[model samples]
Target: MSVFTAVTEDDLARWLGDYAVGRLVSFEGIAAGVQNSNFFVTTTLGRYVLTLFETVARADLPYYLHLTAHLAHHGLPVPAPVADRNNEYLGTLSGRPAALVRRLSGRWLTDPTPAHCTRVGAMLAGLHLAGQSYGRRQPHPRGAQWRAEVAERVLPHVGAEDAELLRTELAWQAQQDFDALPQGVIHADLFRDNVLWDGELIGGVIDFYFAGTDTLLFDLAVTVNDWCTMADGSLDAARSAALLEAYGDERAYTEHERRLWPAALRAAALRFWLSRIEDLHLPRSGEMVQVKDPNEYRRILVARIDGEARLPDRP
Candidate 1:
């Protein structure tokens, strides 16, 4: 959520006239994320987040917008798209695909407690269940195929050790069979920054652009890798257990999922590591671009590879 396309007050005021969100009162560009141009917009009716697609193709926009709406309609706390007077969710603004979603209250939790992890775990499981009936079928955007393609682009910039790790992991992940695992629509990027919390309770989950159809275990792995880690990239056992426990209460993990947990954690780490490397070396131009450190996930990948951090067996 950075400023790639600038929207002036006058420009936005004109655009808002086409919608029933009331007149635009004030608007400011958000600078917390690396993808897309986001603005915190306030109108006579309520506060909202206006997003202009920067890199995502216009044709792929409907899957994300409607998926969010579906989850929200099922009582999941997510940002549902606001339809215009014509009852359309997609629109052209500033020559880019744009959308407006009701802004969820609360700030992101930077330093979370085990209680916070538990809440997010349960909410994520509920989200997965709610999305089972969604008719869309998009593959995980950052899955093994994407990682393999991106690895070729980033290998030139990394050291020999990092390059070897990338190649080895890509090949290993390719050989693994995930077809036996339960699959569904997943919030593939459910990092702490993407979830909002009012104190210990989850306010809402935001940023569904990365959501897609994937194994439920893979989604849990992506979440635990971020929410249950220490600064040194070591897994926090108590928090990880809490998260897994809460999630299991909603939908119990199958034996296959439990057996693949270790590998799934490594795959999640590799996905983010590869993406951060791409962003650092092959960045897109934006007024407020944020290039995160690839080494952070690199360390995490190494930790998952070297350490024995496994979820406890179901009781």
Candidate 2:
């Protein structure tokens, strides 16, 4: 999350009174992502992550926060939302919905190896399995409908060739069917930045705001698009193979899922491309908002369509 909304130390201290998280020793605005306002909060007792929801509806917060708790209860490395003295996981701070999660150890990787991909894949598989019982049903926000809407909003601002590509890709995505594929809760944004690493092991996974009910394969595709892609946005065979095989070892891939892997990869790429384009064309004012390059995912979409992205042969 980004620093769209400013949370002054005094503002945070007043909010801290609602929780038993100890006195706020210090806090600072986090300046990385684009969805919400985030800060690193340190207290005498412990450290925590403070988040202020920007665009998410208030009622919808529980589905995401509770799903994180559910995964945590299942022994996943997700950060569980910390409840206040009233045992509430959500509150209002600086006129926005706010939350606290115990700060987790480890740092995110900039350049992950095949071994790292293997660990991420296994953890993702475990997440899918554990998510089966969450029993909540929030639709994936970046589905086909959202793609079309975002594409419509962004098309006029792009070049003719790029616009044509977006149109054709959206049509291709609409024709696909995932009814036969395994479906469950998915971390719709499991990019490298969302995961924390301690040595060779995964120590933490954050940013569950994008988690939702969707094809599990789509989740895997999203991870692969970010974690296993080269500078030109083509998949690295060794890294992708390590990840796919590791995931398959934990949870077998269905024949249908296997057949649709390439399409899933393309779909995942398009999702990010559309969002990035929107962010670039229709940016909002914020303190630490990162407006990413839409072309990054555009290259990925092209690579997937060119067959550079392939799921490993199922064992």
Candidate 3:
């Protein structure tokens, strides 16, 4: 959910009614993101997440809508879009195109253990397997892609050492074999906040705004980077194992995938590190949001690259 914009109840209810599957009962704002406004909406029929698009590319939304629907159809844990009576999935609400999705049940896990890591890994793998059947790919955006957003936004705001380390990492990444990784659809942003948990089980995965067709293993690497890397730059063995085993359960890896895994993990770490730094320096329009420190992940990435960290053994 994007929290950068202001959304009022009456403003949403009026627009929401046009596309709601049932009579609108109540709408409450959920302040938790930097790109879109979200509301926990209730109706005579069920609960749903009402989103007001604030700064998405607009034309690219169908990918998220269709992808979630596809995942739901394949029996993955994702909230499907609640269609209007006319079968319209996307509708104009408050002058912006919006959609209501079934609110997934679960909470953002505050304490993620190794077992949770494994479950998350498995869920991602299942999603990746399901995504292979999707037949569309959005054209790569022109100008700055997210990978470069760090240097463009954050480096200028901090100490020179941070900037220098980030720039060096970016240059090093530019020389890596990005295309050599396994290929398929990827959920580029599946952080802890995105995965909902019910006790030890992952109830659902939310926030598909960054879902796209990319390297399948790269997605796994991304998950491992987010869910397995610790604050002190060490890869937690049990957590890493859990995640890898979870992913392996859905999509078995090839020799090529195995060979590229380590580098991909390093690459994924750097990707988020840069994005965090970018957000720190370039504050988007939002009421003060807490931005994570990029240096932590930068240290994590360096440790992974230097063989100072080890991902758990996978068969």
All candidates' lDDT scores?
Answer: 0.90, 0.91, 0.74
Q: Model 1 scores what on Cα lDDT?
A: 0.90
Best by lDDT: 2
Q: How far off is residue 175 in model 1, in Å?
A: 2.0
Tell me how far candidate 2 lies from the true structure as C-alpha RMSD in angstroms.
Answer: 1.0
Cα lDDT tens digits, model 2, 140-187, are: 878777889999999999999999999999888888887678989999
**What is the TM-score of candidate 1?**
0.98
What's the CA error at residue 308 for candidate 3, in Å? Answer: 4.7
Candidate 1 per-residue lDDT, tens place, 252-296, comes to 888878778888998999999999999999988888988888888
Candidate 3 lDDT for residue 160: 82
Model 1 segments more than 4 A misplaced: none
Residue pairs in candidate 2 whose N, alpha carbon or C atoms collide under 3 angstroms? none
Q: Who is ahead in lDDT, 1 or 3? A: 1
| Candidate 2 Cα misplacement greater than 4 A, ranges | none
Instruction: Put down candidate 3 lDDT per residue, 136-197, tens digits, no spaces.
Output: 88632211256676466666687888677767777776776657766667888788888998
